[model samples]
Target: MRDPNFSHKQMSAPDRLPTRGLPSNSVTPSGRNGVSSRGGEINERIADRIVRVQWDLTNLKDFWKVHSSPHRSERLAEYLNAELKVLEWMPFQAYDQNERVDYLLLKNFLRNQLSEVHRDAELDSKVLAFLGGFFPLRMANMIEARQRVDDLYHKKAAESLVECTKRIILVKELIVSEKETAEPIVALRATKNLEEFKGHWQEWYNFYDGYDPLFSYWISEPYPKLQKALQDLIDTIKKVCLGLETEDEDTIVGEPIGRSGILEALDTEVIPYTPEELISIAQKEYAWCETEMEKAGHALGFQHWRSALEHVKDLYVEPGKQPSLVRDLTREATAYIRKHDSATVPPVCAETIQTFMMSPKAQKMNPFFLGGDEIIVSYPTQTMSHEQKLMSLRGNNIHFARATVFHEMIPGHHLHMHYMARHRPYRQIFETPFCIEGWAFYWEMVLWDSPSWQKTPENRIGMLFWRMHRCARIIFSLKYHLGEMTAEECVELLIDMVGHERATAEGEVRRSVMGDYGPLYQAGYMLGGLQLYALRQEVVENGDWSEKEFHDTFLKANQLNIELFRALILGEELDKDYKSQWKFYEEIKRD
Candidate 1:
């Protein structure tokens, strides 16, 4: 049986307040002297506070060190000041959940401890760490979200590529200390000693975190029709710089960068048919989810509906009552699955159990099972109200259902969790979200494109579906996060570029910008793809290479961003440009 989804909107303001739950004597910070806090100076007091935060984080890491209970992880989020939201809108019962606290709560917490906290940098770092843990899963969701949309305008893709280029320029400007630019990265970099890398890490996080939303907002909310406009502007600039007919100019000028040219390009792109027919096609595709769900023995009557409603409300309203509900619900679902023989347990879940059957190594590792439901994947449909339910479902797709299973459960994310369970020594580093998420994100394309899944026409279609989603994700992310593309423009782009409907496109746009960890969805893929591609190229160029060798080495290595991975494989050092630069950060210097 698919796992039940949870909702956080059911949580009241009072329930979310972090009152009386933490250990009262939690390692008191000894920091003082506003100057030390404001600037990047490392006085004893500031050092002590940083150490305490790290220690507290380490404690949480230790708690999940060798265990396979997503429930326990959910509980950890509560202590860490966060809530979870799961969406159930598809027949495949795809998982989509957001685990995060209110931005206001975090903002206030930072304000209260302003003197000792490098607020922006510190907050960004923590958020990055949190999101990084689930980076790949989120990226898959974003890509799926984009593909489900029915319209396709290539301009959206162009917008994303341009945004990435612009950011590259922005980082280059920062490295060179260009005038009129903020210096968050530089401030963050100031703390990069062995004892202070975490602090320095926050500085880099601060720079990207603040910039991401502003960039996303331009594409998403206020002016939601920016994609075509931005694309046209870019095309116009390209035309002006390197006359339209010149190949050399084309290479030098690159993609479009402005609005007018993109708008004109969008206008000229002909729609294949009526919008109503397009919507109908999308609806039919989405209905497969319901069919699949029923086949898995999901009873979608009033009883299940009522129970779902009651269960979600109680999750936060009566936190005291959650354990019983969770237990009873999980038991009932597990029993139902056993009786029906419809719910297929994944390979990784089985592998985890086998490994933990307790060989001495297994005992030392203490591996265990984490139910599929506990990770809390929110579906695209749950956010809709009664009137919008049909429309919402119509916008959903199963393109990433298989990819999700691979990335979240098998040789990808679940593997990361298994490693965390088996290897307690690296728990502190292991808990870092970027490493976890990055690895999973890296696999979405890797697994989808693998020959194992491409054996038949049906399989090929599935692969294309996934590829389409990835393309859409790239389009939506760039348009929303960087190019300032709007939902309508994004929808039009989807129609023109990938053939997804407008309703689906709008949903993708909303999720890309509005949801927690949304930015990471795009950033993770960009970062992960860059890393995987660069590594494969490095080995291929350096020696007689094999995909099997690359795959095995990648799977066994530290799941951190490209920097650490490149360092291990190629013997190169990298700067914080790990977040950007497509090649290893060291490669940027070489270039």
Candidate 2:
């Protein structure tokens, strides 16, 4: 099956165009305001049309159906071509930097879409040209540098074994020199080089791993030996710089401890919580949630808390119905948020959030509302068995649906994406899951603190289930990556600790491990939320800014690395050598 996430463009040849002496027409005017009067009008008109077409396409009951259809692809390509032709007549120089960036990004996205549908070398060349025009000089230089490295690899492919070995030795020396320095930047550079070497070595090793007569004549045992050496070097460097070890030490020691990929990517330290510490936190929250469930059971007149949960799950709409319980919950959450003026929901986002049913193939994963004011609610299909429907509905109960709506819409991903679309278009490249997922998760924490939303004990329990789930995500995902836990163990942990149904727990584990979600993605929810929370305490809680002021300011800053977000919020001057030292989670009280 085709991966729904990626486009279908197949590369033929590399496009390497130098940045110097690019046509002057490609350069945009320098200013914060988008474009001059006439240019702005034209750009706005084009952008509006694009948005209209996109909305029309995305609002379909089966958007993916259209996406996968050949006829639909042809039509889309035609539409995009017409749009590109209109854009070509507009003078790029008249537009400001932000407008230019948006225009280029839009153009690139459209062209890539077109390319996926119909492979065109000419279109690909135009796409590359737009990319060169869009990127800053520094970024272009970096791309050129990478291209040169690729060129060298091809050059060595035809060379003698002796020459290739000599080149390898030179690269190895460079790697060792970079690793010798203890500076963080140097360590980072060394890590990147090691990664590059590993890729290059792997390609060569694959050809020689088996007895391929054409390649075997030239390649020898030295190839596998070099691969092993590169692997060892990579492992060693990761251990020293990333605080990662090859084996789990928790069994020998009392508690598990290691650096998390998520924390490292966010430029933060490993959380101060040990495995035991995290387990303790989870246990406390779990017990509190159980108590809340008991109270809810009594309030609902149920014999047991499990019965209350089951009843809530049964509140979902029947299989093929509109106005899903989830949708209703979202509307309620949005109305409440608006009443309190907790955060401003952009008018566009408020109007554009449309709910659609997830396809059968997609229903295996959790129902997700993506960033762009679009919600995909998973429901049982007509062909599904009774057991499947029961499992599906039970996994997404009223309380769970209510708790998640705000996280995915309004003041969560929708609002964040809306702001990011207009402001700091150039900085969109710097987006990380830590900021994106973290911002949404931060809203969850914020709404939970507000009494207006989480009024009922059941609602509180629902919210806490998600919070504890995030904590479990951190512990389980990190442990799995560190070779301390298996996917089954992670699933069991969810089922036992968080009261997840066996099927739901298995699905969650599968999604976490099998999907494109990175090693740090699961951890990002809780960790990122805590990071933002810590920043809020330092900035807003201290009276430097109001809660609304802080949140609005943060949205305006665009998606940034957590440390960069801190630097921007605190008005700290940053230097090239600056490293993350902010232990935001250190002072966080888990319970």
Candidate 3:
């Protein structure tokens, strides 16, 4: 039942973006604002209208406090649809590239929000359906009423609370008496939905519990009874449905969003390629990485890439010396990015890079590292078994650290945050992992192409290890969400294809598909990388902007979607009917 692959052209041997070498410490930002502060050519009137609409959304959301209420949901959807129509009809034919791009991205954002509303409602329905057609949504109605500051009837409201309590008791009894139930995701959502309903009831109750003496007099007794009944229902469902009494951190449980859900999310990111097309691109990248690894392996006196990978894994620093190693690697990468003029490294970003060691407990879920503000280093602790200690050490080897240290520190996530805060900072609301993570992943590709970054064959292998890992992430994540692969299959694919440690593979799989992330997250690393890579070709490699100029412009644009960013950089003619169809990667045959 696997999906067929689709077309996306790629370079047989990718070329580098241009730059002139500069000294490391000499890399200082120009102009008062931050980096190369070329006076921006923004169309103020059009841009302001878009921002004004964003503020309208902000105010509207502030008013709609009860998110799950059918009335609020319908109202919000209608509001968004109206905005979409206005933007659709708005005269943008005379606007410049920058203004049209702003218009284009905002329109897509509204459309994505609407589609996601439907997706969310689909999930919400599972909760009520699992409860056999009763979900206690009356409390959300009360909550909405409170949000509106409607005239409160103390006696009637108290009776409504008593009725909700009765409903909770009935649901709890039904769960306990039932012989069968919905699938795990439904039951799991049912418990979560119950807790949410309980919270809504509390929100309705607390608005006047202490503020109005008469309201408290009526609600105080029944409120506690309803609260207790809600808690009871949640517990009973968890025990009877999930068959577990406590949270299981190690077991990976993810609700797969089918092809339609996947397509909707990709559309939101402004990614024109289908999931099948992206997977095919990833496979090509994977093949290229293998070939490069073999070349590196030969230089490392090994006949095979796997053997070279094993040798690199054993290149870890001694215990208790990782902190110093990170400090040194961060310095190395900071120097490299500047030497190549890859991107501007503000003096503050270089000085303020921070590091913190990850605990053994946290390492089970994140066996490698986490970035932004501070790089959370994951390695062995004093209490771990010998096997766990060795796995952690090899997983965070010196070579591996060297490959991604810049990614976590300067010229990667840390610098990304620094620039985003300084330039077009308000656009943080429109941020996407495709830009955030893609920027970092794009750096990985650029550095790999740099002669100095990966100085040795082992260095190339170290960088290639992460490249292959990104490829594997795209494959496993998409397949899992498309119902073509299970979580176990995903873990196995990591271990078997990417050469990941069993424990490390499990951790990566869990982190990839967890509830906190969308299904396309894992695929973002390489997909985003390849996107920026292709865009670099058009803007820097072939266009008038030098590498430094291109990088500087992108950081300041606050462009969340790369395709829209492309429009801004290229300044091509854009009218109202613009759509995303950039085939950034063009395939070439290698000798």
Using lDDT as the measure, which candidate wins?
A: 3
- What TM-scores do the predictions have? 0.36, 0.55, 0.84
Number of residue pairs clashing in candidate 3, backbone atoms closer than 3 angstroms, sequence gap of 3 or more or interchain? 2
Could you give the C-alpha RMSD of every candidate to the true structure, in order shown? 25.2, 17.7, 9.6
Best-matching candidate per TM-score: 3
**Ten-residue region with minimum lDDT total, candidate 3:** 1-10
By TM-score, rank the candidates, best first: 3, 2, 1
lDDT of 3 by residue, 91-203 (tens): 46545445566677777778877886676667767676666554356776777788888999989988888888887787777778884466877777677767776776777
Tell me the deviation in Å of residue 67 in model 2. 25
**What lDDT would each prediction earn against the true structure?**
0.34, 0.56, 0.75
TM-score of candidate 2 against the unseen true structure: 0.55
Candidate 1 structure, TM-score to reference: 0.36
Models sorted by lDDT, best on top: 3, 2, 1
Worst 10 residues of 2 by lDDT: 248-257
lDDT of 1 at 272: 23
* Residue-level lDDT tens digits of model 1 in 389-454: 333222222222333444444445555455444332222232223356556655554544445443
